[model samples]
Target chain A: MTTVGEALSALCTPALVVDVDKVKRNAQMMIERCQKLGVQLRPHMKTHKTLECADIMTGGSRRCIVVSTLAEACFYADHGFDDILYAYSLPFDKVERCAALSERLDLFQVLLDHPQALEQLKKRPLRDGRRWHTEGVELTGIYAHCGNTYNCRGVEQIQAVAQETTSFTLQFMEKLKAAGITCKSSIGSTPSCSHPVKDMAQLSEVHPGNYTFYDVQQSVIGSCSLEDVAVRVLTRVIGHCPHRNQLLIDCGWTGLSLDGAGKLPTGYAMIEGHPNLKLLSMTQEHGRVEPISGPLDYSKYPLGSLLTLIPYHSCATAMMHPVYHVHSGGRLLGKWTPTRGW
Target chain B: MTTVGEALSALCTPALVVDVDKVKRNAQMMIERCQKLGVQLRPHMKTHKTLECADIMTGGSRRCIVVSTLAEACFYADHGFDDILYAYSLPFDKVERCAALSERLDLFQVLLDHPQALEQLKKRPLRDGRRWHTEGVELTGIYAHCGNTYNCRGVEQIQAVAQETTSFTLQFMEKLKAAGITCKSSIGSTPSCSHPVKDMAQLSEVHPGNYTFYDVQQSVIGSCSLEDVAVRVLTRVIGHCPHRNQLLIDCGWTGLSLDGAGKLPTGYAMIEGHPNLKLLSMTQEHGRVEPISGPLDYSKYPLGSLLTLIPYHSCATAMMHPVYHVHSGGRLLGKWTPTRGW
Candidate 1:
């Protein structure tokens, strides 16, 4: 049997390596945290976007979950995951697919943050002339996103944004009620959800995707510590430019993603256990690494040596790959392929 | 028959729309430019990975191409493309696959920028105990990348780096010759190739990938003009958050990649014909658009209205999609699915 450590040698460069032990711990901690705060942890699948991770996040119940794409909602629904929230403003083009999914699944919901979105949803209906609660389709809720929370400064800033978003969602829900459509209100993002507030009682559930794979960005934002990160891009040293004092890695923007670093450092991502090594820049297939302090021995990072990095944003980085190489105790357990598409 | 413009209404939001007329013009312009310079335009397939685009790039001959990944090499080779160059430095683990491909195709090349990479290639032997060259497989060339030119400030800086890179590559090719393996020297990038350097005669071929769909980044780098860009992300205004002076669109990091805007304005991407509208930020499924000058006139961008934006980096944005919606004369010609995987 090929162990995870051994499998890295066989797999291609710039691959996603998921520590299942870390993943479970991350999932469990978040689940417990939300439980303490009296909120259901409807784990957002946009971060990991795999059935295996979803199962672990939901504690193998597959009862309630959240997704960013209609494709992901259909994927989980097909895999027997019933209660799903398509946690973005509902695209009018996908209503039919959502209706089809809602027909079979126990509950399949979509977000409608704006009144215009609801108007668009109303314009598109089944041939039978029914709207949100048709025979085959029933939207479980109307989700409102405080995406602005991502731009917030600290916990207090996130909390204030969360409070405003919750009020806006409550009022929007009232508009839906006035239209004779009754549905639950939903709100979240990692930062907003991490801050417990009195406004929590207004929303039905919280879906914070990045908590499962706390990235360097999240750590910088005070959502989680760097130690809480569960996923890393395993890359190899390909070349060393002596004059430039740079080490070239197989991980490029395509691997690690070009997600900007916020208040962390002047680089794309951070190298695990290598505070001195900063990813200075990236091309499509080449990541330029420079020592933050100063360069001396290029011999230390020999060609073909493996290096793991914590991405600035886990969702953007994870979306680059087709499969996650799942491992535990440094043993290759299996692979988890994400549902691809919009 | 579905006209291209008509097809946009049916496709999922945030789809890749390729103006084939622009693409043809772009290809012909680069091809003719290379012809005048006395060089072959081995159009890099990394921008548009579809075979149809490759055919157009090769002017229907489909003879030679440059790819970013082994997956692209295998993909094009499987589609009857014979001569292929995996443009980036060959990862050590991919040598076996490279050897296997070289055995079947007329020509299959890889890159070697450093001596260590060449050393790894030396260790990996073909089935019959030959390293690089065997009965069927032969090393096509020693490729070099002027990646440093991407960091260059101006035309002169790029020219200087291009000159240096060519000399470096030529010297490395001589090192291979000393090891009893004769091979050609290859080098190129959009900026270096577009500069029309006298050093071009030293390399066997020029492989400029992004010229096929010159982006905002390329335009800023003096590679091409904004009008030459052929690919765009088609998005719809889903919401207008007046409080934030932002319009929410279906395009997000998942649709329009997080590749930074280099020397461009402080936005994620440039909306074609809408200089006022700046994509300020993005979540996984939400792109926040703001007016660069003043508050966005929400009426100007009606809900569900489609807008196209030129990505900062075409290759990175195109990588996010599985297929390209081909259009010309404001008519949908057909669909082009890119070969996906590593």
Candidate 2:
């Protein structure tokens, strides 16, 4: 059992502490879910941007992986991985550079929702040694990508897009096949992953990263339950103003994020297991918690007691602190420090 | 002059390119403005998170600096800097850590809004005799915090609490005064920063972060103007689907975040300089732009042309890309990469 003193001094403050057992379980569970559905796992690396996290994928062939940025691509590629997909849309200016990057690797796949996007991307592949300038080539189409409808639109839109993305991928694949080109096609988005795979049979892979650490967005979208979220920031009750009915906290824009990207505008986060108490707001170094769930139980949760919270958005919250203090078997074990700097 | 090709190629595509000149101008301009109003400059490091950026402040002193993270505090402290104010609202659990960290440096100030937060922080200021916490026993109460109306019931509610914070700080200062204590008290936030100063004017300092990079939220609250926005993302059109009148581009979730924090339902971003073009939605890799203004002159502004746009939340957008490509004198200079990830 962790005493109050031990909990306070066990790790650095304002640092990300993760439950290793939970993280492992989350990874295993996602892999098993995909396996049962017969969907290939090409998880996105943007969630856990660390080599150590990449090495802990319960079980999967190293045939394919998805990335949001080219920096992530270069990171995984340098580790001797071959098949990679740059799932982000690219500007025409970077088309030639992407083609050059594709040539250096064994397999590289690009995703584009618009015909013109595909045209520019297809105009130059890695087949030839010389890098062709798409700038000199005549341009025709417009690229409007809207596969993820999580923010403005809700879960229903996400599901439709998943279905639409699969059919759209098929159409694009048909054109590529007609041109005698062979490439790996993929389907993704944390929200869309929960939908039934309509064309999973046609797709070569499925790359969804946040499924391992589902948030309020994923939970509301019917991806997973609140308990399934693996990542959380363990914080404390620092200042209690009975007058304002608000308690002060150490978690702020830096410890968590100033982002209110949840079903509700929860300014900060919720202390797990204590649903009523919402972290109402924050400044640079402080957090305000309102007793929304029930009465303020200062007995179980005194000023010095520790409370853990699952952030609303994993990507945004994860960017708040540096190292992840992981726990397994209810004891502090290892640590996972993510790569920093843009 | 940088041709479009040269500008895109010379700079790293996914880097946070900051034209040093623009940054210098931006920083210098803000400092001059604050000085004219007699407001002490405690520039928020959440924007740049770079030591070099901090080193170039208009004020030559080191004591008056504001930060968003503890890592930043440690960085500046290690660099022989002192009198740092963690503008983030921290909880009681982290207060001890901040106190402990204060030992290595000269003085570390923190923001407080709630009584419970301060209560929690006060209880755990020092843990062991063998190890001393950074926050000296001096209780150097440079209490720079804000209790604004948006979060508060009204000015009257926080006005009392603001007085409480000032008094709490004064009480702490009074104890020091008895033992010969000398400390600086400060207050900051956009809302109250504009209102007439009351008892808070006694604070030795005042600072605000987003006042520099104002967005629609600031404009709504009447903090800054739409023209005061210093940064925007430059994207291009890649496809044109005749059936839907839908336009697609490479700037999607990876380009723009899925966050519509303080924006209309148009999407995460709008077409800058082309208000008529509404950003209907966004996917992981595409942004669906439609013409709210008449049809584009396809001949002059075809699918391959570049368009500049602003972000709903500059903080998130700054974290998404690695480089901030600075354009100056019609020339694209070097890049400024912000510190990202916790």
Candidate 3:
């Protein structure tokens, strides 16, 4: 119900606010990066599943994209998006739904890491003469996630992991060629894709999702700088717990998730522009905030005062919200409702 | 969109299933207990925000309920439920919404723990002849939540905390009476209310929420037994990581929350009927589960085999799902959609 052109302060507390400008810049940068590498940028929609954000991530083509869940695949497919890649190992129970999407769309690709899953797809064949990846039970592409790159600390470490993943994938491709089986290859992860190695250019595609709205975790891993983070949980000071030396904010574990516990000097999330403060703990609907050092100057954070929290993991934090308040330059533009469930 | 009367195996994996029979039993038990204690039970709806669950918890009276957020208060009020008590320290930003509810409903109560919050209410006068409580800026009730009872390990410890909280609340009530400012007094928490002291009857009312869907955390804290828990996350084994001696489940942090980390011997959640398996870690859509003390027995758990997970914290886990599949005797009944956001 927040009106367009209204300031962020007009919205309620514990609200997820997205910087549209940052989103566009991040998406544009990733698109340009993938274009330069000559690899398709199949941006993952798990971070922000809204159609508006998906449109931005795909640069309005909505042709090639990656989704972590079948729910996202259906959501996008229903909205004219095609050539979708459901990047998770296919769940057996959802094969029927996936088959329907495959028949309806121009192309719907599913991943399988096991022979049993391949059998599930074979049982549910696509109608109208459509085949599963050009032929029945034919291999489409080798998708490898450089998830280990999340442990890297800097650009050098990120590139090293990316290089290692690309080399292994290329070597596997060579083995497939030796066996007279040729197929495409892809490797992805936000960190690896953000600092992609030269060898990654030899791959078929790159699927990185979190780069669209990079968070503190991404910044720490050198995927993007702190300024590149596009989302913030807007909360307000609701109570001043002087006895406990903690200020209770309206944001809690329900608003901001418990994803980054004990991982930051600022517990849970970083208090934007307030390094001395730490989010001590959270209940269902209340967060305890206190200073890292000296006594808190309560006058500075009076009742109803605004505080911005830069979440540690944007994907986890985004999942907690039903709608994202899209804003540009601190003014609300509209609300983006993300589709939920599997 | 799962059909009724279908077996649970027919539904998708990672879906939250609610045992309606257990839910009714739990609600009936709490009602009988409160009736025997000669105290009014104002059930908290923060744990399960669905109208159906609220109807069950309130015994269909649709009155005398406590909500953790204004959104729930509005949702219940819009559905013809009244006599709602927003059981949190009043946030200054929500005063207008509180005022609207106060004017709309026959009785809508707001709580404030600070003088500044009181001033916020004073600034916004309710419409018509309605007064804030008895008069303008009047104290309605003194509410206290004994959240510390969560650390208790047995019924004796729970009773001790209940007795202590009741004694403290009664003492505070006496002080208010001495100052000629008598009003209602209430104290609550699942652990404290589950094992109430005789002194709790002296209070005006009691509010307990989580007993409706008792979780592993509540059972561990002596609030309820493991058998009394009514909710389970139905996931499936999608991958077998033989190299790591692990099985990847479709349920992840997105399906089951990370609330009970390091609190249980079984890691995040307890695998029902399988004490040896541990949910070690989770990504966005993949949970790495392995045996607690030995290699995973993948033979017993093939691809797509259903695994029931007893959540450590039902409230945290329930918040992650958009819909709750209500069932009885392993047969699906219907789906319960919950209202989200502040």
Candidate 4:
């Protein structure tokens, strides 16, 4: 944590501080891409869920937004982000609470690719028989999210699930139309979003949260590149053993999520700002910094100096901290705090 | 996330849920272990940092503590835990902040292992003949944490580190002795604690946090076993796809800390109760569950059902959630929030 001042001076030690300027650059770049693609930008708040950030990301209007957890939805909704897509398919048991939240807002949506959820929804007693009574009072339709990938293959998997999604949508519209349900459907994944075979006319809208920060996983699907990672975990060297050619650093399992990009290095995180440095492996509290070139930058990576680390997967990396230390250049800026859990 | 009532109610997912009864049992077990070992138990609040749990663990004394970050030290200090060990070695530049925190507390200790840290302490204002003047009064003598683990091989490693630790302790104490300097030296790690050579009489106390919650890593190091693992992350199966021989579950990277036991499976967490169930792999938002045996009890892992997952490393696992859903068996128990951040 950095110490506070008139312009709070940054603290030493390679901590998980974010550069606010980098976030702005990242956000603005995404906004531009969304504009070019003609897609509505509902940036995933799971990355940096701070109010000051939400204001900047939303550009003032409580526009369409994406959230991974119900707590996030409640947070933005309470602060007035009405058009919400609970991007992750939360369990059916949470429907009642989700319904209660929906009644307070103007627009709330969900994502689902499983048939069991629809079955659970139809059977659940969410209506009082007048205006849809759940818990106690009368509300309306439950917020829905549609999943685009499930045991998905190159093409066949999505075609099968899209067919399921299409049929499910028809069935849902039929049920909601007859019973006067007020639910909306939005379907997408990074794969479907990048190479969309289906049209917008097939669905109400689309939710592509990862499109903003494509990772090695997205690159394998031919989406982005190694240079496009918007965020990285900053760390420092702690122990160096030359005989083994391994340098132990503070960034380890806790610093970087043990997520792998299929067929790539198991150590998903790479050391940025340095060309030769690569993270070969990690333990709970220590990361093994392996250099491609033999014994490079021993001085720069001295036991106390900081090093920037970009993770294999972004969302999970984002979730590992309580707040993002927003920054730009070498200056200290603001912060962002994401909501966790259902 | 389980509801306050549901978490407290009857069955917990797989197992990390510590019922208040189990919490008491676990806390008491450690306290008793410490008593038998003839050692003072300065519990690492990192496991379960709830004040309620702290109260139970301490019984009633302003006991010494081992914290990972400065924020944690300040947090517990404000809550009446005056004696603390900031168990992380910070960069040379952050020495001032540690000193500032130490000045505020009755006794605040920071970890130091490398020569760089020794140089950092040596190059303080004392070397410049300019005493640190912070927040009005001139403060002095904040204890230092000397971490040395190379000696776990035998008493030689302990003795070597003790030699180094004693020198550092003597130097720090000599510099600030006029200001009433008193140092608290903790010369131990889980491995060393499991096999202590000599009781480094020079060292004042011992700190072996992971010893209390023996994990698979510790077990490999001959510390503890599966039964000794008292905490686990509970999750439920949401989707199953046999074609890939992979089953998708709601628990993802955020729910589980992508930390995996080596060679066992590159992905997935350890399934405690059901030995056959294995976490094959995972994505940012999904975990692939598989059965190590043929035709397993798929009932316990059905959609909406729960399973507790033992962690690869206990410290990393504990940070994934804000609260612990405690349980005792057929009874929903209580909730406890942990202390987070530096």
Candidate 5:
């Protein structure tokens, strides 16, 4: 029922609002970064699974995207997206579905980390002349996730991890070539992809998802600045619990998620423009907010007043919302409904 | 695409399965307990916001229920449920929508904890000559949630908190009566209601959710036993990370949520029938699970094998799932879709 052109304040509280301008800028920057690196940018859709965001991330090509679940793989494939990669370690129970996608899509890829998974895939061969592998199971490629970069404090650490992953991956690819089993190689993480090293240019492709919607964690890790975070949970002050020295907001764990707990100076999320205010805790549908240093000024935050929260993790927060209210400069554009479930 | 009479193992990984028989038993127990106490059992729909579960919780009467969000209120109202109480401190931004529901429903109630919220309600009087108050905004009642009971470890501690809350509520009701403002008084929490003090019978109504789908958190708090818990997240072991001494599962924070972190020895949730295993960490789509004390015997859990996860908090876990695969004695019955968003 929320229409276009309305101010963001008109929407209900605890709404996830996406700054479309920032999304486009972020997506464009990633695209340009990969273009410069001479590697394909296979954007991951696990961060924001909506088709509209997928279009933005892929520059409307709708090709060469990595998905975390089969549901996403099918969703995008059904929407004309081809060259999809089911990036998680292949789930054994979903081989049939994976086979269907393999036969249907022009280039449906799957990842496996064990021999048993490969056997499972072998048992379910695609029909209609589709082949998942070239003779004996094909070595599709080597994919490494530099997830340790998440613990990095800044760009220097991130690039170090990226460099190590690239060297190791390149070394493995050389060994594969020597064994006469040459295949493509790819490595990624938001931190590593956001600040790629010179060595990463040697890779075949890079798949990073979270860069499209930068968040407080990304800012803390020096992947992007606070200004680059594209999404915010727009909540409103609903109650004043003077006795507890807390102000209640409509956003809770359901709205913002329990991601980045104990990692933030603020309890759950960073209150934009209000560094002293900490989102102390949350229940099912109520978030408790309080000042970090001193007593709160109740007169400053009256009932129904809007408070913007920069989420600690955009992927986690975005999953809580069924639809994202797309906006540009505080004016509503429309909505982007994301696909859910595995 | 999932159908009835199918074994749970036939479904894909990371599916939330609810035991229908357990749900009926839990609902019937709550109804009988409240009936014996001579109090109106207005079950809460926040835990499982599905019409089928709501039907089970309300004993098929489709009347007298509580919801945590306005969307839930509207959902139940649209489905012909009546006498609804939105058990939330009145949100100022939702007053107009609340007014519409107030005018449309046969009996819709809203909760307000502040004078400003009351003022906002007064500004928007109900149409069709339906008055929210007889004169000067008549007192509706007092409602208290003994959330502190969540901290209790046993039935004794739970009843102690329940007794204290009931005494305080009765004392406050006496004060309201002394002030010549007679109205209904109600109080509830899953733990408190599960083991109600004798004095709770004197109250006009009680609202408790989560009993229908009791979880590990409630079981730990002595609200119910492990056998009483009705929900389990069905996941499959997708990989064996022997170097890291872990098994990867399809249930991540997105599948089972991060609500009970550090609270359980099993990490995020209790892996049913595997007391020795711990869900150490999770990424977006993968959960790293390992043995609690020693190296895991990976042979015992091959890839494609199913693992049952009893969530720490059913409300939190239920929120993560888009559909609940209802089953009876391990045979799938149907899917129950819950409402989302505020």
Candidate 6:
């Protein structure tokens, strides 16, 4: 039985919790920044995958959203999201579904980068031994990925990669034009989109998904500050092993995610206020935190005490849970369920 | 469209494929080994939360199985499995659900390691604002975690850790006895259980989960042979970048998992039959494989060509997929859907 005062703490251990204030601030900040830059902010629903959060991101407009999976696309589409971009390169197995969704929505776009994908996209076949006739299929736009920007060390490097990616995408658009099929091309990654670009006149849209939930990896890549991290895993200290100098937590790789800190050497995640504690290793259900200084202070983190961790990569961490417990100022707000499946 | 002959390759890119024959073999080998060792093998269903797999593992007995999550416990219980051990230390929030589940099953055990967890266990609270009478709440046993075995270097270290874990568990069991409550105590990890033990008079059963589908991480830890691996991720080469010296695959951190080969210098995963191809990096939907040797032949790996990857950790990798495509001797048999969510 959970009392009203301890509702958040009473949740199951290793639960994914989002600071509502942080999320709203993060969404509003991105919206304003994108507005200032004169580009529409197509929030990637892949991060939160919640209708409530999506409504906040687009200010209830549901104008444009990006999805990583068809399941997510179907979810937002059912929720009245008119313009949805299936940001992944078109896979042959999902062509028919995409085509059908395109017919239903005001705009539904699928990405095309590789030649084989382009060829498959042109066919638009269904898994049920039927192909959508060329005229029946309605594709919103072709999207390109500036995935290499993730490797960029600085803003200048990211900008150069962005230019290269833009040129490459435009060249692919020309190929589509030569094939007698033409559409607007969309391109952007978090790193590339976050970096200032002089020209996006050649592209129809920009999709930067991870900007909504900046993580330790983003900080290491110089994409966002540590203070900008929105989502965190709420966990409990389960045990303390003095011999091993480790503090076991309920959050494991399944909760915190296995994506390591890109350039930061602090380990898997950063404990909100424990600078001396380093998450050195993890199992499926247990996280082992080692002290960077001397022997650990057990009293500092008593058993069953709650601790929040800024994940190494928010996108990957979000995939491990079904719902996000939204909270603000230690008060429980609501729960947001993520669209699951591939 | 998916035709009969192209079933394996036709479904989707980056899908989890299980070799049924290999699973049967792995099951049979472990069962025989445990029989010879004079121990009851309580197979942990956390690795593959499939009823069919569980049936094979338990030899159609449907007697004993271990689960990582309450959802898995419920899954096997609903499928008529009599004994289910939720192999994690008890959390306060789940006490009520655990109590109700205990009422439904012949045996439903929850692990308790810390003093606080024990106090919560003694309380026997439920989520629906009711208290489970101590007499009404039936706990099968207390399970101990030898999680440190994951960090052990070799068989000797694993055995030593096993002894230490067993002793620790026995001490806790003694404490429970002193408190006027007594139950069987269980302790084992894959490493400890796989290694031979002279005595087990103090422990009731061994729970070895990951031995069912061993991976590169298990192989590196000297737990299982690489040949014993029963599952692999089937992916497609989406693009080949000659300038970048990388082969991009449909498998990403989402499919193949972000769990790296612990203690092994190999990147994310080992390419089946492609030793030279190192998984250098990953994004949400793209895995970057760089050739260890000079790479000039794009023809060697044509676009959309299927490739198999032996994951770093089978348990973590399996969690990413909704269903497992069962195959034997290169023939598609059936699809096994995993129970999703917490």
> What fraction of native interface contacts does model 6 preserve?
0.48
Query: What is the C-alpha DockQ of each candidate?
Result: 0.58, 0.26, 0.91, 0.38, 0.90, 0.46
Please give, for residues B72-153, the per-residue lDDT of candidate 3 as tens digits.
9999999999999999888888888999999999999888777777778878878798878634546778898999999899
Candidate 5 local Cα displacement, residue A106, angstroms:
0.4
Instruction: Please state the error at residue A284 of candidate 1 in Å.
Output: 1.0
The residue-by-residue lDDT of candidate 6 on B223-291, one tens digit each, is 778898989998888777888988888888878777774434458888889887888888788888888
The alpha-carbon deviation from the true structure for residue B211 of candidate 5, after best TM-score superposition, in angstroms, is 0.6
lDDT of 1 by residue, B1-342 (tens): 235466656667788888888888878877887787776678789888899989988999888788988889999989899888887676876777888887778777777666666766666655543346433335666566676777776688878888888778778777877988786666778888878577677677788877777888887776777888888898988888899988889998989887865446848888888987788888778888988888778788987788888898889899898778887765677899987667
Off by over 4 Å in 1: A1-9, A35-38, A127-183, A191-203, B1-7, B128-142, B147-183, B195-203
lDDT of each: 0.79, 0.61, 0.92, 0.59, 0.92, 0.78
Find the 10 residues in a row with the least total lDDT in model 6 chain A: A129-138
Pick out the ten consecutive residues of candidate 1 chain B with the lowest summed lDDT: B128-137
Put down candidate 3 lDDT per residue, A1-342, tens digits, no spaces: 578999999999899999999999999999999889888888889999989999999889988899988889999999999999999888989988989999999989889888888878788878999878734546889999999998999999999999999999999999988988889898889999998887888999999999988999999999999999999999999888889888989999999999999999999999998999999999999999999999999999988999999999999999999999999999999999999998
Better of 1 and 6 by TM-score: 1
Q: How large is the interface RMSD of each prediction?
A: 1.5, 4.9, 0.7, 3.2, 0.7, 2.0
What tens-digit string does per-residue lDDT give for candidate 6 at A1-342? 333445678777788878777777877877776676676677788777789888888878988888888888998898888878787767766777888887777677677666676577666644444333333334446676677777877778988998888788788788978877777667767888777575655677787777777788787777778888878898888888998998888888878777774434568888888887788888788888888889988998888788888898888899888778777776667788887666
The DockQ-derived docking category for candidate 4 is: acceptable
Candidate number achieving the greatest DockQ relative to the actual structure: 3
For model 1 the local lDDT of residue B100 reads 85
Q: Categorize the docking of model 6.
A: acceptable
lDDT of 5 by residue, B70-162 (tens): 999999999999999999988988999999999999889888787788888888988998978534658888889999999999999999999
Q: After best superposition, candidate 4 residue A276: deviation in angstroms?
A: 1.5
Q: Where does candidate 5 stray beyond 4 Å?
A: none
lDDT, candidate 6, at A341: 64
Candidate scoring better on TM-score of 1 and 3:
3
Query: After TM-score superposition, what is the CA distance of residue A326 in candidate 6 from its true location, in Å?
Result: 1.9
DockQ-superior candidate, 1 or 3: 3
DockQ of 5: 0.90
